[model samples]
Target: MSEFIEWGALGQVVVAGLIIGAGIPALFALGLRLLAGTTTQPQRAASGTRRAADGGVPAGPVAIARPTPARLVGAIACMGVVVGAIAFGLVFLVSGGH
Candidate 1:
């Protein structure tokens, strides 16, 4: 078995495969989580208000907070890694695995 397989090269291929396959999706998810800010819920109207006529529930638009500078940077970095990996794979394929 050892004679049939170059263990070192196979190990490297497995390691690279695992990293690219798992790391890219994980980074993308992290970027999305970082970029997704908190949503502001609609406030309830005071008593006897026009909105109160509709069971005190005011129909208002939910506002999404903008990501902080640090979060934005983090998201960019994470997504950049994912994109870079994809581009590298594409280039590798186009280059005929050269």
Candidate 2:
């Protein structure tokens, strides 16, 4: 049985499993805590102009900033490349490759 089992592969698998299984939940919980305030009720307008009964804003159009899909994709691709490069370097170092 020992002859059939590759310890390096087994260690990699275990490390990968721990990183994904444990890291994901921790990151998710952290993100949830960071965004917890967004779900709260909106604060009442201070001394600003009162809204009409129709609830229409008298101000000009509100500017809304949104992340574009292309930018998001680019960011993700960049991160993937960075992670891949780091992993490759780590693997090379672990395997004693100069």
Candidate 3:
């Protein structure tokens, strides 16, 4: 009698699904995080202007961030992987990988 379960194919499918489903999102999130970099202290106005609203809350300082070249490259790489995965998916679908 033939085996009912194709363990090898099932495993491959599960692994591929896990990698494509989880890894892609993780890479995208990593790219965003790397691009965003770390935030420094809030920036103060150059003119040294501070305004108080009618609600009595003073205006807060603006935020500033700068990403290093390495970080930028890493971010680009991660995003590239994500885009490539998407392209591969499109091609796979078009080629009837379904």
The clash numbers for all candidates, in the given order, read 0, 0, 0
Candidate 2, poorest ten consecutive residues by summed lDDT: 34-43
Q: lDDT values of the candidates?
A: 0.87, 0.59, 0.83
Candidate 1 C-alpha lDDT tens digits along 1-98: 58999999999999988898887898999999999998987665555444656675676666899999999999999999999989999999999995
After superposing candidate 2 on the true structure, give the runs of residues whose Cα lies further than 4 Å from its correct spot: 1-64
Instruction: Give candidate 1 misplaced runs (Cα > 4 Å).
Output: 1-6, 47-59
* TM-score, model 1 to reference: 0.73
TM-score list, all predictions: 0.73, 0.36, 0.75
Which candidate achieves the best lDDT against the true structure?
1
Q: Give a tens-digit lDDT track for model 2, residues 1-98.
A: 48999999999999988866776555555544433332333345556654686384443334434445655555555555556656886899999996
> What TM-score does candidate 3 reach?
0.75
TM-score, structure 2 vs. true: 0.36
**lDDT of prediction 3:** 0.83
Worst 10 residues of 1 by lDDT: 44-53
